[model samples]
Target: MSEPAVSVARYLATTTAEGPGLRTAIWVQGCSIRCAGCFNPHLFPTEGGVRWSPADLAARVLAEPSTGLTLLGGEPFEQAEALAEVARQVRAGGRSVLTFSGFTHAALRRAAAAGRPGVAGLLAATDLLIAGPFRRDRLDHERPWVGSTNQEFVVLDDRFPDLADWRPGALDRVQVDVDRAGTVSVNGWLDTDRLDALLADL
Candidate 1:
């Protein structure tokens, strides 16, 4: 059977702000759990992004010289099967995969137990998973990548051994890039006040 097309909202070749090291990032399109105060509200609709087959997406990511791949919203698990294939291929090529999701780990486990193959596949392929919804009221100031204190960081396998030693209070880094046409794109975690200040000066 042919693989389903992956709706890609954004693709960055290399960025340190997304994960543990310089990594290729793919922001998927469409989100079922539209959390209040979500950062990428524009990505909530499924119809906006360009679609690519899993093989093609994996190839594009592998061509990059980054150390790993980071999968971000709309929600990786929503398009789990295709993204799982991409993650498997990336790992086969000797790179790690980090995935973010709005669903809690327990909920994901329940889905998997109910025979959701895609969810199982994606979970198996992911090396690190930042799970849980974005809670605006519970902003996380101490963690490295997560936005809320409710999110759980799960190290799925041995890929990121050093992650176990990772502690809170690590500073979050943001990246601002301007394309040739002067389109500015920003990623990473930042508080509302600081982000407003940064964007105001831009």
Candidate 2:
């Protein structure tokens, strides 16, 4: 039987802005939340993205020397099964996993407790989970790895012990990448006004 595939909108081989260290970032393609002022509005559509097998994607992520893997999306929880498999593979290779979700940790815990398919598996595979829907009004640029003040950083495992000592208010965040095709992409949090100015220039 063939391995399950994930709907991937895009992926960055390595990025420091997404997590604590250099990490591989995978952006899945679909979201039901549709939060206003979402940074990646293009990813909201359920359709339109390349389907990649978990094993293949894991291999690509592991090819580079990364401290961890960061999963974000349209919504990572929406495609939990495939991501869980990828997380499992990456963890087996000794890399930590960080995930971003639109759902709260409490909600995910409830889903896991109720025996929802993939929810428990994905949660188990994650070492850290940044949860909550993006609120444009609550946009926060001071905190690391979160888009808004309403979101939270939940530690699921002790792999990243130093995270406890990390302080907020770092301004040196965000990364801009221009692919060979000249398509520009931005990652990480930017306050509403700055983001608007950046977008206006683009």
Candidate 3:
């Protein structure tokens, strides 16, 4: 049997800002939620991202010296099966998995209970899940790991025990990365005004 293919918009082999430690971040390509104030609007389109098999993606993520894996959007649950496989492989290598989703945990629980394909597997493979739609009105600048106040950090496993007390302030919270193609990207939570200033300086 062959592994499912994942539509990948972008990926960073290593980054400290995505989670507790150095982590590999994989941003999937499509999102149906289309929240009003999405930071990565470019990823809304359901097409145009490069495709990678689960095995290949797992190898790429594990190739680097990362403490864990961070799954970002367009929406990780949108391609649950592929991401599940990737997470499985990463965890098998003794690394934890963190995932961001536009769907709430309750909704995901219902989906999993209803037997949605890949939902249970993905949740099972994840250690921590940041779940909720990004609400512009409820944007939270103080939270280090989430975009909005409504988002909840649901720890599915005990792998990331430190997150219970981890709190990152403005300094050293955001990470800026420029790929070989000269595409500059930012990750982590920041105040809207501060984010504007940071982008203006760039």
Candidate 4:
């Protein structure tokens, strides 16, 4: 048989609260980490997402000027193949790629050491990387692209990994009013289990 077809779960194109500029955000699907307070447990159920082609994704991202691409959950790095292709397209088109992950930079490095494919390529082509997951205990309202203090918005360029823009943070966090009809229009990651429990309680 041919090699197993690599499939990646692609969520709807959404926006970010604190990143660079206008961005075409892709929320990928699937994760097994099961962090107790994961904001996006809905992503853990992979069956709900659609499969977007790398080229199609690239086209939508490029349609706007001064807009970069931001890769979000279920965890962008979980499927290296998906991210690497995204990186390649963005780089080739002279745009930047930003990604948020539940995995820490050190964790990704460790995975690469253990022969994880696509990490190097993805990192190499990426301009920014927001590493680590959101921590309920470390929540900080005044940071960039991060919910908790533990999460960092890292610029992965070889020359300036230690730099922090320290720019005035953008107002990207959002609140939603879910109706009884179950409309789910919101921003940032959602803690699915907690949400379900809350919904059930209501």
Candidate number with greatest lDDT = 1
For model 2, what is the alpha-carbon lDDT of residue 152? 85
Model 3 root-mean-square deviation: 2.0
| Per-model RMSD to reference | 1.4, 2.0, 2.0, 4.9
Off by over 4 Å in 3: 168-172, 179-183
Computed on alpha carbons, the lDDT of every model, listed in order, comes to 0.90, 0.86, 0.87, 0.65
Ten-residue segment with the worst summed lDDT in candidate 4? 2-11
* Residue-level error in angstroms, candidate 1, position 33: 0.6
Over 4 Å off, model 4: 1-18, 158-166, 169-171, 175-184, 189-202
In the predicted model 1, the residue pairs found to clash are: none
lDDT of 2 by residue, 44-158 (tens): 9989989999999999999988879999989999999889999999999999999999999999999989988789999999998989999977766567778788998888888
Q: Which stretches of candidate 1 lie over 4 Å from their true place?
A: 163-165
Question: Which residue pairs of candidate 4 clash?
Answer: 17-172, 28-73, 28-74, 39-190, 39-191
On residues 1-202, what C-alpha lDDT tens digit does candidate 3 reach at each position?
7667999998888888887878898999999999998988999988978999999999988898998999998999989988999999999998999999999999999999999889999999999898999999997756677878899989899966754444654233788877799888888767678889998898
Clashes (candidate 4): 5
The TM-scores, one per candidate, come to 0.96, 0.91, 0.92, 0.75
* Candidate number with the higher TM-score (1 or 3): 1
TM-score of model number 2: 0.91
**Candidate 1 structure lDDT:** 0.90
